[model samples]
Target chain A: MGGEFEGVVRPRRMRRSRRGQALVEFAVVLPLFLFCLLGALDAGLWAVQTSAEVSAVEQAAMVASSAGSSPTSETAPDAHAVLTSISGRLRSALFGTTIKSWCTTNASGDCAPDATQRCPTTPAEVQDVDGPRVVVVCVSEADPPACATPPPGQVAPYPPGCEDSPMITVRVVGFVASFVPPGFGPGASGFELPANISATTHTLRFAP
Target chain B: MRRRRRRGDDAQAVLETALVIPILLFLVCNFIAVMVQVTVQEQLNSATALAAQSRFQAPENAIDPSGTRCCGAPGMSLATAGLPTGCRYAAETFYGTMTTYTGLLHWLRATLCTSGGDSGNAAIPPMQPVAYAGSPSNAEVSCDIGSIKPGGTVIPGYVDRALNPPAGLNVVTCSASASLDFADTPLAWGVFWTPTLHAQAEALPPPFRQ
Candidate 1:
């Protein structure tokens, strides 16, 4: 009876089998394997977003540069119109969603001495019939019209006719979406990714 | 007795998993950190290129003339009158002289003369220094005296300076800067272990013949 009891329970035989060892090893590695897989997925998503940002900026610059004949003179209205249209196009092509945009001329004093006077108006003499004009478009996250609108009652302070200078600066700003999972941890909170892009083009001369 | 022995064996798998999970998590996070840094660097490079190009093609007005002042936009022919001999706005006569006489005396005198000096002495004394100097003064003279003077040349003209860009075109120099933070992730902790990448780019304007 004791010999039959020993035969029925065979714990040593089960412990010595390779199948048990294999099971233990798999359990040990599964967490690590999952971590690696998820990490790769996260990385791939980040790469795709970054590529989209680059392509958008490149396309915008090319479009702005090629707008008209050589040395395109841009008026504030004209610049705003062009940038608004382009921003819409880029939003559709890149994100498949519409995004807010603002356009401004790089009328900063550092880049253009007469930027103040030249920034808002067509690069024409206050009264003269013919002159080259340059307009810079700045795009940002602000809403349209409101984004492009300057502060109220701000008269261009610089002398007139300075607007026709050849140097025009354009800037575009936008947010890049984050890839981190929401509510994961304090570290996984929303991340703000801002991109600023700028380009320059010569002003076109307008006929008298 | 057999049941008690089986319970101890069951805990082995749990203990092994606990020991290995943290290590695997660390490795995965490190990989992600590396990928994020690369993406940041690429973004920086693109931004710099765009900024530089914007600066390069920026309208001529954006450039600070520094000390130079813009006089009236008189017609091209008006630029030559009373200009120092050899001062050429569009006229051929002033070209050789303006190119050779680039000097302080020549510039000050040109400024005083072109603006029609407020006083006679203001005009006479400045010219005296240049008139007495023999054998081509070292001071740089303006080609178009009425259009620009030595004190006024500080404004950089779009077409004036020589900048060698790609394809044999000359361009103006503009600068750009950017800062970015890595996304918050368990992997971001690994960023401290890796190198951050930084880069810059320069662009030039279309070439013009002198």
Candidate 2:
């Protein structure tokens, strides 16, 4: 009976081999498990950061909208003051972030720095989807006046006053570094997220 | 010896599972909890902002269109007429908007099934009146609007009074708080508690006096 069983299975060697197999399985699963764990951690942090940024931008927009714009400077210039107030509201780590605001004829303007689209040359009558209008904040893809430094002779790109400013675009641009590797497991610290997170809000200059 | 070795191999598998399972569960459950926390926080932020903005659209409690009479003239003592009309309207608007926003948040809570630990099955409480740290007179939704001065006390009027200040500009602010209860989550067994989340926002009324 013993001889027949021995031929069928080598028990001692099988036991040791089985232990080796289990170790091999664990080793194989460990990296995949850790990769997923770390990835989730990274993504969760990113979502939180992005929401914070959007809220900050929205708050800034509300401030600007309430104050409305004016050619005449008040205690603080409306646009600058609004941006500064937003900066004050955001976390100190976001100090490098820039706030841009502008007015234009349509939503064809880029409100970010280094934009090239032209502001309306004159207060030409522009159609408003809701009402007749002369100006609208051109934050769509149009050049933001706050971002540009026009030549001395050229008209100021962002004209002042609520009527001169039919719409206001407030944009906040900043970077958020991940707490974990950008694309994969924990050790890929060399990766830096390529693009920044930005939030843009357009509010009618309702304060006239 | 062979039987003993086989038994040891079985024990090894059990031991490895025992060591790994709890750690894995901890990580997974915590991940879920954090995700829910972020979602709730984001919802709170949006609600707070919209509520603040709504305060501007409220009818200006004004006898005049310019809104000059809303508060007495500059440096004139506090208006004896009780809270300014714009202030009261802003408070009512802010509170109403908060209720609407909070109701909207129900969808989020349903999807996530998380709430402040104290709320249990109930919805988060509505916005409450909070005075600036030191100024008891300056209620969260009060006509005594102003900037924060040296201590936490809020100075009762706009410094830039140049814009003729909007009606809702009377220092009307909103704040809300709720806890993210991990007790109801899969992490309940592991995480005994969650920190409370809070949001506060300030806005001047819309500049349109009418």
Candidate 3:
């Protein structure tokens, strides 16, 4: 019965095999185009990331600069705070979380040279985006621009004026995933690693 | 009959592919051009931010000593002669960051240095910008720094930038908006649209410096 059914087999269904080379080429080329597309997309996202961090740091420094010389560690709110706040509810990270650094006074030299170490050592992610990223603040100023003893007998005025200038620096550090093959984005050779982007800014502090 | 029909199908396949390959290539070129534009936009944002932040760094009272700031990309150096030290710094930062792809870009021209547009800008019209007294004529990248020498009284900048939305934040800001064109490049054949990219940043003024 099986032989009888097989005996009636029709002509081979070889229409797909007719364009076997085209099918093979498509298979080879599809991945290449997709990879390039991803790289292009990543470039846009990278710009967004950088802009967000810069905005965050610039705003924080501006706010803190107004705090006067004796700034009491006012680290700008990260994305989580933004997500919860009234004004910030409308503003949230479009891609991933922003890991803002707790501002440090007179500690510029201690910042990690590596971008990866700058954020939380333990990687954090929201969806495909990495976390513990964004602004790092460093305040540089003469510890006390005013005299402690007030020249022994001189009457020290309230909120004494400082002759010294102060500077506040903010830095943005971001890690982005790079899937584009070699000679594409981030990687010098191989791919599949998080690309590090960082920029540093320093401005004279605003002391009211 | 079957053989003749197969030849016709092959010819049609070749014709379809011939029509498609150029379109695909043009699409890819546009993609790459867009990437470059994104990067340039990022640079513009950084430059503007630095310029705003730098305004604070410059002494509140100092005017442009050089009467001309030096050191930006060659063409972009936009004779910032007779502008504020702050404006000079801003120009340098802007031109400096825009070092790459200068030839490929067709920037939206603005007055190199401006002061006293407090009356209004194109955004909040009744638009009358205070004249840029000493800024070179060929300058692009217009910036308004409050006002200058109005009735012989010079004002450095406003506590609140008149150009900014009146939220009263009193923050120093840097922003840049410009269009990128690849007309001079071979890619121009494929990329037609010149995208305008923009970014603006703000920081609070220093208590003493302001």
Model 1 misplaced stretches (Cα beyond 4 Å): A2-4, A10-35, A65-208, B1-12, B67-185, B206-210
Q: Write the per-residue lDDT of candidate 1 for residues B1-210, one digit (tens) a residue.
A: 766756666687667667667666666666766665555555445544443343223233332222222222333233333232111111211121122112201122121111111121122211111211211222112211111224533222222222212111133222222232333344455444434344444444433211
Say which prediction, candidate 1 or candidate 3, comes out ahead on lDDT: 3
- Candidate 2 lDDT, B1-210, residue by residue in tens: 777977897789779878877777677666756665675566456555554554344334331122222322223322222333333233333332222123212221200000111111113232222232322221222222343434545443332232233221334454555555555444686565565677776655443533
Per-prediction fnat: 0.16, 0.10, 0.25
> Which 10-residue span in candidate 2 chain A carries the lowest summed lDDT?
A126-135
Give the count of colliding residue pairs in each prediction. 32, 10, 9
Ranking by TM-score: 3, 2, 1
Worst 10 residues of 2 chain B by lDDT: B110-119
Per-residue CA lDDT of candidate 1, range A4-84, in tens? 877776756665754777776777567557647755765665555544544454445434443432334433223454455
lDDT (Cα, tens digit) per residue for candidate 2, span A93-182: 332222233432235442333245333322122221212111122222222234255567754332311112223334433233455434
Which lDDT tens digits does candidate 3 get at residues A1-208? Answer: 8866644542133365466747875885697677657756665565564445445544544443333333443333332222222113113432333443432223453323231222322122221233322222222222225545566665553124232234333333334333444466443423332222222232344334
Task: Give the DockQ-based CAPRI class for model 1.
Answer: incorrect
Least well predicted 10-residue stretch by lDDT in candidate 1 chain B? B111-120
Q: What is each predicted model's overall lDDT from 0 to 1? A: 0.35, 0.41, 0.45
